[model samples]
Target chain A: MGCERYRKYVGAFADGELEVKENLEFLEHVKMCPACAARVDEVATMKGVLQRVYAKVEPSESLRQRVAESLGDASADYRHRPRSGWSVQLRRLVVPVAMAAALIFAVVIWPSVDRFRPRPGSVTVVTGRIVSDVRAQHTACLGRSGGTHQAADLPLDVVGISNVLSRELKLRVLAPDLRSLGFRLVGADRCGVRGHSGAHVLYQALKKDAYLSIFTVGRLPEVVTTSNAQIFDVFVSDGGPLAVLGWHSDKASYLVCGDLPKSELLGLADQIRFADADTQDPTEPVFVRRDGD
Target chain B: MGTETGQGNEDARTRFERVAMPHFDVVLRMARVLGTGEAEAEDLVQETFTRAFSAFDRFELRTYGARPWLLRILHNVFYTMRTRAKRRPTLLDDVDFDHFADELDEHASEPVSADSVDWDQFDGEIKTVVAALQPEYRTVLLLWALEGLSYKEIAEICGCALGTVMSRLYRARQLVGRALRNYASQRKLNVERFN
Candidate 1:
């Protein structure tokens, strides 16, 4: 079965609802698939762990009383209070009578609050001890680099590296391909881009450990392109320990990061460059490979 | 038989007051296991009683008995409340068990033998570890473990599909296993640290 098809069956397999034949088939597949086996194991472990973790949670005595009392109060209120119809009539007559009388004495007053305005999206900054620890680690890395490299863990700064890189490469580039992956933008900052002398820009994802950092240098020290390569070429290559993909268009260069296989990265880079050629800015500097020097 | 019925009702009320009331603390403890905290747990028990008493008319003393009935009400009320709103992810959030795979990299590769394990200690830890599950998982396991409800009754009470209840129970058991393994490792680490 395909992965999504297998995913649907995982719940059933966990329930032992599969027929003997199907169960054997599923288990056979599981034997060959370590990732799926690990997932099943984790799901099982997570369920049991959650049970024990919540085993002793007692509502506070006061909250218990409050809920009970609230229930009692609602019952009493319902019994005693007039239902909505009668109350509505009473409020209408009384309020109108009051408002009519007050209208003569009422001064025309301007309201302080704005009404019918579209509300802006609220930005929430989540600060946690974990983020603090990461920040501290970043500071330590910066110190190790003799303050020349401001090693920071913020995601947005990594994204911003694309802009710096775009400027240097004289081509339009954007960090964090939002459409391809549903990654949220995190904070960004300037850091020593790994190989370049000048500061490298960085951007990051809000949740995951994924980051995009680019070194911005003025021009590729040498114009190097293979025969098959055009203004923009996307290729996935083994980036030593990490898998890397580099894409170039006439305008700018983009590099995506992950432990992804070289073929996948290169394919993605090529596809992106082909699709987004005209939309990108030409002045943005294309990214030069660090090893090229 | 009518006389006997009246007598049975009287006895049921009296028994409920005594036997079930004393089980208040235990029931509360179980309620927590089922995902309600101290206050909500108490309300759960109160609601359990209110429903149990009101439905006392329908309950057959000869059939399934009071414990299961009371637990059924508790489980029903818990899932009802839980389903009404988005539940806050409980305390055990971000505790991914996958990280335990990294511990294999540590020294001391001695594998523990099954014979070396103490059943009593293991059982006790199992209880505690099960106690430590996130509220969502804990609730179903509690209905199974503490109340001894069958998967069918658990599904009915939890208002989930039978498979979901069974899956949850199985998963809950697996988590208990992981917790036991984690506890054993932590204890070993403590011993090593002290040494």
Candidate 2:
């Protein structure tokens, strides 16, 4: 018990922390006890060493500037904006007293600007995927017949098509171009026109809200050859002003559907040619399912 | 942007610059032992003033002038940052404490009076030794010897119990004594690790 007391108070003696009377008493104890005295001495030495070292280090210059800048920036943040007393008083009274005035203003001009402007392609990752998917579908269709055309309405199926294309080919293409041009990708199921089982890729990216569909030929029938003049004439010639561009390769034919003037379709088709066969997979791909239309 | 509000903020800023910027050198010196560079110390001091001025609306000048309040703010700011960046690297940690002890012993044996100890050299040696202490002990000694803070005031600032404060102060004093004695023993007498 006495040793415990000494150990607890030893740091105090080393520090000169006791009252004068207590200091004298501790000094007497130290004079008689070697172990306590040594402990006290070591603590005192550490204290002195620290004090001297603490005294010498001064602040450097640039650190001062950065801290000031940080403080100034914090003060200027929008949440801290200062306001006059009168403004606070005015807000308190005006907000409660003028509800009727506020309601009418909100109703008179709210609907038009709030109209749905689709934001599907806003995200960069989605935008890149949308472009790649559209390009690949167009090129693959051009591979089978000398031409191809949408033989059905497939908005319901287009959602499924988006899933299939993303699953099999992993594309994130969007066809909102149909909506702007007054058309939409609307419908589902398989169709055989000119002996080819063509799946419809549809969209509305033009005026009059037209239902445009591109027929992607999965397997070309043996009958769809150079001699099928009616097939080539209707699909390739600018008939009904329903512009279409189609090409055949070793596997299939890809047709882009739209009421896009024949000149524009030809130009778009020329641009599609073939999806770069060597495009690497995305570093990260997010899985998405099309549920509600 | 209100005229009255703008004027009030501007006034506060002006007061801070006049009263606070002048004492930057002293505050920086205090901060260095607390593990700050010249620039960071100055910044800590500046931030201390900015906080004080913003709360000046409640300040009671009758009880205290801006100095003690500003210094307390400065101390709080330094320690708060130190705690937050708990592992921030420090240069003094790179020093070899054992080799430094040897040098102090060699110099202690010379037949020299306290005045004969070169002030600049002594200052340098003392600084190195102080920097070697842990923050807990260093704070106690510096607040007492250099900042002249009373034990009660240090207890309040450090948020420690009175007994704890006293013990820290005691340990601080002992360390200083030992360092000085070690220096003294080196001058002529060979001393063991402890008497």
* Candidate 1 CAPRI-style tier: incorrect
Candidate 1, residue B128: lDDT: 68
Compare the candidates by lDDT and give the number of the best one.
2
Q: Candidates' TM-scores? A: 0.32, 0.39
Q: Write the per-residue lDDT of candidate 1 for residues A1-293, one digit (tens) a residue.
A: 53433543443454334444555566567656654554454333333333334344444566457544544443444344444788767876898798876664454332223343221211111123243443343334443433354444333532244434333322223343432232344444343323433333333334534443332332121212331344232233333423333443332344443333444345445444533332222122122111110
Give the worst 10-residue stretch by lDDT in candidate 1 chain B: B101-110
Which segments of candidate 2 are over 4 A away from where they belong? A1-87, A90-293, B58-64, B88-119, B187-195
What is the C-alpha local distance difference test score of candidate 2? 0.47
DockQ of each: 0.03, 0.07
True contact recovery of candidate 2: 0.16
- The runs of at least 3 residues in candidate 1 whose Cα sits more than 4 Å from the true structure, single-residue gaps closed, are A1-293, B1-26, B35-37, B60-63, B80-132, B189-195
